[model samples]
Target: MKIKVNSEACIGCGACEQIAKDLFEIGDEGVSKAKVSEVPEDKKAMAQEAIDGCPTGAIQGEE
Candidate 1:
């Protein structure tokens, strides 16, 4: 599974980070962005939660 972030849709909220800090992070500009971390298949559920929990709907899955 690959995580994709729509930077344009992100509103700098830390919701995703709160849900999955290992998979996401606040960028230098303070926007919520995908962290350069590996996500195991078992963590897909948590990742999905983070994606769905994003208030700005900025996160998605590639497959």
Candidate 2:
């Protein structure tokens, strides 16, 4: 799976980064960014958690 952060929608609340630092991060622009291009099999659940936890619904997952 691939994860994407929509900069326009992100609030930079850090919920995503807190959920999965390996997959998401707060960028210099104060928006969440996907650190990985693809989610590892073992980390897919964590990525999903981050997506669900995003208050602004900025994260999107693509299978």
Candidate 3:
């Protein structure tokens, strides 16, 4: 699975960070964005939860 983040829609709420700090982070611009790392299968659930927790619907799964 691939995760996509809409930078324009993100509010940097840190919900994704709370769910999966390894996968997401708040950038200097304060937008919730993905970190530069490979996502493990164990953290997939948390990643999905983060995507769901995004209030602006800025995150999505690609395939």
Candidate 4:
């Protein structure tokens, strides 16, 4: 699966990064960004957590 962050919806709250640092990061633009092109098998759960934890629902998972 792949993760995406909606720049327009993100608030730079850092919840996603805090929940899954390996999957997300606060980019130079001040919004959260996906760190990898795809989510690793072991990181899927964490990625989902980050998505769920996002205050603005900015994170999305794609097949």
Candidate 5:
């Protein structure tokens, strides 16, 4: 599985980073983006949590 962050949609809220620091971070003018393209097996659940927790629905997941 993989994760993608919509730069336009992100508001730099940092929720993803807070929820899954290993998988996400604030970057590119302070937008929250995925730290890795492919989600690690152990981090997958937290990645989904970050996606679901994002207020703007900016994080997208790909299998």
Candidate 6:
């Protein structure tokens, strides 16, 4: 799976980072960014939760 954060749409609320720190982080510009391009199977569930938790729908995953 691939994980991506839409920097233009992200509000940087930190939900993604908080829910899945292994996959995301808040940048110096205050937007959420994907720490990695691909999501490991072991981390997909947590990544989904992070995607769901994002208020702005900035986090996305593709399988």
Report lDDT per candidate: 0.83, 0.93, 0.81, 0.92, 0.93, 0.92
Model 5 agreement with the true structure over 1-63: per-residue lDDT tens digits: 899999999999899999999999998699987889999899989998999999999999988
> Over 4 Å off in model 4, which ranges?
none
RMSD in Å for all candidates: 1.5, 0.5, 1.5, 0.7, 0.8, 0.6
How far does residue 19 in candidate 4 sit from its true spot (Å)?
A: 0.7
Model 5 spans with C-alpha error above 4 angstroms: none
Write the residue-wise lDDT of candidate 4 on 1-63 in tens digits: 998999999999999898899999999999999999799999999998998899899998987
lDDT per residue, candidate 3, 1-63, as tens digits? 567778999988888888888888888998877873446778788888988889999987654
lDDT of 6 by residue, 1-63 (tens): 899999989998998999999999999999988999989899999999999999988887999
Candidate number achieving the greatest TM-score relative to the actual structure: 2
Which ranges of candidate 6 are over 4 A from the true structure? none
- For 1-63, candidate 1 gives per-residue lDDT tens digits of 788788889998798888888889898987877774456888889899998898877887766
Model 3 lowest lDDT segment of ten: 32-41
Model 1 TM-score, 2 decimals: 0.87
Ranking 1 against 4 by TM-score, winner: 4
Clashes in model 4: which pairs? none
lDDT of model 1 at residue 11? 92
Q: What is the lDDT of residue 2 in candidate 5?
A: 96
Error of 4 at 35 (Å): 0.3
Clashing pairs in 1: none
